[model samples]
Every structure is written in structure tokens, then in C-alpha cells.
Target: MADLTTTLCGIRMANPLVLASGVLGTTRAILTRAARAGAGAVTMKSISLEPRDGHPNPTILTFEAGVINAVGYSNPGVEEALAEFADLGDVPSPVIASVVGRNAEEFARVAERMARLPVAAIELPLSCPHTPGYGTLAGQSTPEATREITRAVRAVTAKPIFVKVSPNAQALGEIAAAAEQAGASAITAVNSMGPGMVINIEARRPVLAFKMGGVTGAALRPVALRCVYDIYRTVRIPVIGTGGVATGRHAIEMLMAGATAVGVGSAVAGGGVEVFARIAAEMAEWMDRNGVARVEELIGAAHR
Candidate 1:
């Protein structure tokens, strides 16, 4: 049999499949359920210093290619998150906390508080495309912003930090490299693409209440793969390839693109948490059939 176990910044996982943030990671129960369902690791939804109501209804819309969402950064805030995830003794897989803020100070403060918990790592989503006063809309996608935010968080937590970047940034590789240089332990390449829009045609307005949202699903895979590939070549840190991964073959393609682990988000909406087990099994089967004894061997195979 082929080994699916892998490690990210010293945190070991039974498989390379991770439950991406903001999918079904709304509560501790869901996070635990994802682990029990076969996710090797799980990330909580992005939390801010204060609770947010998020956008109005119709925040999410599904199209033929993928789902576009302007759900905003809705969360119970860090205090509630701390209480919810306080005890991880029962949770089987490692938990990664995803933090977001309006600025470097807020990011650092949130990271400081979240790091006090037992999470295995800290992830900063500095690339959310649809949110105002945060992410790309706030010009946080620049390499300078990446480095500053990463450095701020680094000062507060000794825990490993993973900088989540955007696909829309032209200097995506440079942004990844900046994060690495500023003390990030890993890179989560490519947050959902576009604050894209869909129109009802009949209503003639827009589909989402917010009128725009970040894009995810099959439409994002190729762009995400390319982002991961570029980041890998630019930095020595591990890259968590996120966006549109749905099947074992897609996972394999991400691994070859230089992802230390693959992130699964929108696929869960269609396949449920069981998707993790199915993808892992498929990965193992493919590995065995190809005579690859270890999952690590597949990482960056394309570059080789």
C-alpha cells in the first residue's frame, strides 16, 4: 500500500487532504465531523477581532463552472471561536486556525489570541477578493502588505504561520516569497478568484445580494495549480494548494504542481465530507498503481 501521511511545518496528517476554510467549517461540531469523515486536517472559517453579520441573503450563487460567494467574513469572532475550539483532545486531526483582520495590527491581535489555543498552525487569509476593508479590496495583496502582516503575526505567535494569498495578484510568486521571508512557515496559494458577478437576466440586477463574490470550484483549479507551481519555485516553504480540487486525479495534479497538501472547499458542497475519504482512497490507489510508495515522492514531480 502507498503511504498518504504527510507533514506541514512539523504537524503530521494521515493524508494530504485538508478541509479548506469557509466551506463547512462554521462550527466546532462541523470541524470535528470533517475530521471523523476523513479529512487529514481542518481549518476553521476566517475569524476576526469582532463578530460580523456578513452580507445579506443570496450571498452564494451556483453556476455551471463553480460557485461564486460574497458571504463576507462572517464569523463569531475570535472570542467565541476560542470557546468553541478550546478543547481539541477529542478532535482526531490537527486543527489550523484561519485569521483575518482589517489591518496588520488586527491580524496580529487575532493571531495572538488564536495562538493561545491548541491549534497546530495559524493561517492568514490576506487575499479575500470580495470583502471590503480587508484582503484585496483593501490592497492587502501586494508583496509589501503580505510581508508586513506576516511579520506582525510572527512577532506574536511561535506557532507556524501559513499566509493565504490571492490568485488575482500579478506578483503572486513575489507575494509568497515575501511572506516566507517575513517568517511565514508555509503558503496557501490562491484564495477564490474574482469578485465576479452573475445576473438574473429577468430581474436584470445581480444574483448575489452583494452583487459580487470570489469564485471557486472547477473553474479555479488550473489557476490554483499554476499559482502553487510558481510559489514552490520561488520559495523553499511548503505550499498548500487550494481551489477547485474535487477528485483524486485533481489532487495528484496539485501535488505535481508542488503542493505539500491539497485544500478542498467547494467540492464539499457537492460531495459532502465523505469527499475527503474518497479522494484519499483514490490517491492511494493511483499511487500504488504507479509504483509510488510514498506521497512525498509525488510532490513537485512536474518540476522534476
Candidate 2:
């Protein structure tokens, strides 16, 4: 059998696939189901410093490439998430907590709260695009702010910190470098592009309550691959790729682009957690055929 296991930030997962933080990871039942379905790990639905009901109705729309979301980083504050986090009961290999906040202090607060939770890592979402002026704290757009927030969180928590980035920023390289300087253990790039909006012709109105939001789906794979490849070259720390990954080939592409692991978010939204089982089979089969003995060996192996 091929060695699919790859160590990330000192944590060993059964495979390289991780369930991205979002709807599928919010509830106890959903996370439990994903864990059982062979997802190497699962991230929470993004906890914040304070609870937010999120934007009003019509926050998501379906398109050919992916779904546009204006969910607005809604979550039940760190306290409630802590309760849900503790109930996970060790079913998954290591539960990864996804946390987000507006400023550096807020990020630090969320990190400290999650530090008490039963999680192996904290994926800081400092780059949520739909949230207007906020959310881009770690996205490589604002190097100074990214370093400040990352350094603050690193000072408080020992858990692995994975800083996520936004696609809209052209200064992603500087942002990643700053995070490394501030102490981020890994990086996940290209959160969602556009913060796009679709209008209802008859209504002459926006589809989402927030008017615009992040887009994620099959359409975003190429952009995501580029972000991963770029960051992989720019930094020594592992790059955790995410975006429009839906198949075994896409997952393999991310690995070849220098991603230590890939997070399947939109695909999970489209096909359910069973996608993990399917993709795992396909990847393993492809690996066996090529005599690829280990998954980590595939990193940055693009057609050279």
C-alpha cells in the first residue's frame, strides 16, 4: 500500500484530505459524519470573538463553477463553539478549529479560547472577502497587520496556526512572509474571489442579502492552484491548498503544486462528505498505478 500519510505541523493524519471550515463542519452530527467518512481531519464552522447570526436570507447562490456565499462569517462566539468542540469525542484523528476575527486582538482572543478546546490546529481566517473592510488580516494584503495579528496569536497558543488568505489581494507574497515572521506554522491561500454578486433580472435586486460574497467551486481550482504554487515557492512552511477541489485529480494537482494538504470545501458542499471516501480511493489507485509510494512525494511534482 502507498504511504498516504504526511505530517503537517507535527500532526500525523491518516491521509492528506481535510474538511474545510464551513457549513459541513458546524454541527456535531456533520463533523462526526465527516470524521467517520475518512476525512483525515475536520475544521469547525469558524468561531468568532462574539456571536453573529450572520446576514439575512438568500446568502448563497448556485453557479456552474461554485456557490457564491454571503454567510458573513456567522458563528456562535467562542464560548458556544467551545461546548460543541468538546463534544466531538475524539472520533476524528485530530479536530482542527477554524477561527476568525476582525483585528489582531480579536484573533488573539479567539485563539486563546480555542487553545482550551480539543483541537490539533487553529485555522485563522483573517481573509474572509465578503465582510467588507475586515477579514483580510492574514490574506497577504496588509503585511503589517498580518504580522501583528499572527505574532499575537503565536505568542498565546501552542497549537499549529494556519493563516488563510484572500484572492483579491495582489500583495499575497508579502502577507505570507509577514505571517511566517510573526510565527504562522502553515498557510492556506485564496479564500474566495470576487465577493461576487448576481442580480435577479425581474426583481432588479441582488441575490444575496449582503449583495455580494465569496465564490467557491470548480471554477476556482486553477486560481487556487496558482496561489498554492506561489506561496509554496515563497515560503518554507507547508502550504495547505483549498478552493475548487472536487476530484482525485484536483487533489493530486494541489499536492503537485506544493501543498502539504488540501482542504475540500466546495466539493463537500456539492457532494457531501462521501466525496472524501471517493477521492481517497481514486488517489490511492492513481498512486498505486504510478508506483508512487507516498503522497508527500507528489508535492511540487507538476509536469516538469
Candidate 3:
């Protein structure tokens, strides 16, 4: 059988399929469920220093190409998250804690707290496009901001930091390189793109209460692949390609594009948590048929 096992910053994974942040990662039970459902690793939803109500009702909308969500970083706060994920020993797969903040100080503070947990790593999502005080809207997408935030967090914890960058940034490669220089262990390339909107048409207004949200699913794969390819060339650190991955072929494409691992989020809405196992199995089958011996062999194949 083709070997699917891989490592990201020294953390071993049974496969490369990771459950992306913000999709069914709100609770420990769901995280564990995803792990048991076949996810090689699971990331919790973005947690903040304080609780947020998030956007009102119409936070999520589904279109033909993908999903658009402006959940507004709603979470019970880091305190609650600490309580929720305090014990991860029961989870079969490694847990990655995703943290968000309005600035480098907040990001560092939150990282300091979450680092105390037994998580496999800490993911800094500096790319969310929908929220006002966080992510791209807050100016966290720039190379300078990426460096400052990554450096601040690095000073507080020894845990591996995975900086998640925005797909919308034109200087995507530079931003990733900045993170690598600031002590980031890996780069999670391309968060959802566009705070794009969908109109209700009949109602004559936008569907989401926030009016705009990040785009994900099939529509984002190409852009994500390109971002990963660019970042892979710009930085020596591993890149976790995240955007619109849905199937085995997409996973393979991401690997060839230089992703050390693949992240799945919007697809879970359609395929359920079991999508992880399905994609991994499909990847194994494709590798077997193509005579690819191991998953690692495919990483950066396009660059070669």
C-alpha cells in the first residue's frame, strides 16, 4: 500500500488530511469525533481573548461555487476554550489550537495561554477576511503585521507556530517569508478568499447579515494551489495548503503544488466528517495506481 503517513514540524500524522479551523471544531466532542472519523489532525475554531457574539443570524450562505461565512469570529473566549480543550488525551489524533486577535499583543497573549495546553501546535489565523477587528480587515495580512504577530507569539511560547496567511494578499509570498523569518514553524497557505457577497435578489439586499464573507470550497482550489506554490518557493518551512480541497485529486494537486499537508473545511459541510477518511483513501488509491510509494514524494513535485 502507498504510505500516507507524513510529518509537519516534527508532529507525525497518519495522513495529510487535516480538519480545517471553523467548521465543526467548536466543541471538544466534535473535534474528537472528527479525529475518530479519520482526520489525521483537527484544529479548533479560532478562539479570542474575550467572548464574541459574532454576526447576527445570516452569518453563512451557500452558493454554487462554495460557501461564504462571516461568523465574525464568534467564540466562547480563550478561557472557555481552555476549559473545553483542557484534556485532549482522549482524542486519537493531534489537536491544533487556532487563535485570533486584534493585534500582535492580543495574538501573543492568546498564544501564550493556549500554549499551556497539550495541543500539537498553535495556529495563528492572521487572514480571516470577514471580521472587522481581526484578520485582513484589521491589517494583519501585510508582511510587517505577519512578522510582528509571529515574532510576538514566538517570544511567548516554544510550541510550533503555524501562521495562516490570507489568499487575498498580493504579496502572499513575502508575507509567508516574513512569518518564516519570525520563527513560524509552518505556513498554512491561503485562508478563505474575498469577503465577497451574495444578494438575496428578491429582497434586494445581501444574504449575510455581515453583507460579506470569505469564499471557500471548489472555487478556491486554484488560487490556493498557486499560493502554496509561491510560498513553497519563497520559504523553506512546510506549507499546509488550505482553501478548497475536496477530493483525492485535489489533495494530490495540492501536494504537487508543494503542500506538506492538506486542509479540508468547506467540503465537510457537504461530505460530513467522514470526508477525511474518504480523501485519504482516495489519495492512497491514486498513489498506488500511479506507483507513487509515499505521500512525501509528492510534496513540491511541481517545483521539481
Q: Identify the runs in model 3 with alpha carbons over 4 angstroms from their true place.
A: none
Q: Per-residue lDDT for 184-293 in model 1, tens only? A: 99999879999799998999999888899999999999999999999989999999999899999999999999999999999987888899999999999999999999
The CA lDDT of each predicted structure is 0.94, 0.83, 0.93
Residue-level lDDT tens digits of model 3 in 1-304: 9999999999999999889999989999999999999898899999999999999979987789889999999999999989999999889999999999999999999999999999999999999999999999999999999999999999999989999998899999889989999999999987999979999889999989998999998888899999999999999999999988989999999999999989999999889888999999999999999999999999999989
Error of model 2, residue 90, in angstroms: 3.8
| Whole-structure CA lDDT of model 1 | 0.94
Name the lDDT value of residue 272 in candidate 1.
Answer: 80
TM-scores of the models, in the order given: 0.99, 0.95, 0.99
Q: In model 2, which range of ten residues has the least summed lDDT?
A: 132-141
**How accurate locally is residue 68 in candidate 1, as Cα lDDT from 0 to 100?**
96
lDDT of 2 by residue, 209-270 (tens): 99988888887789899988888888899888998988888899999999989888888777
Q: Indicate the TM-score of model 1.
A: 0.99
Scored against the true structure, residue 6 in model 2 reaches a CA lDDT of 84
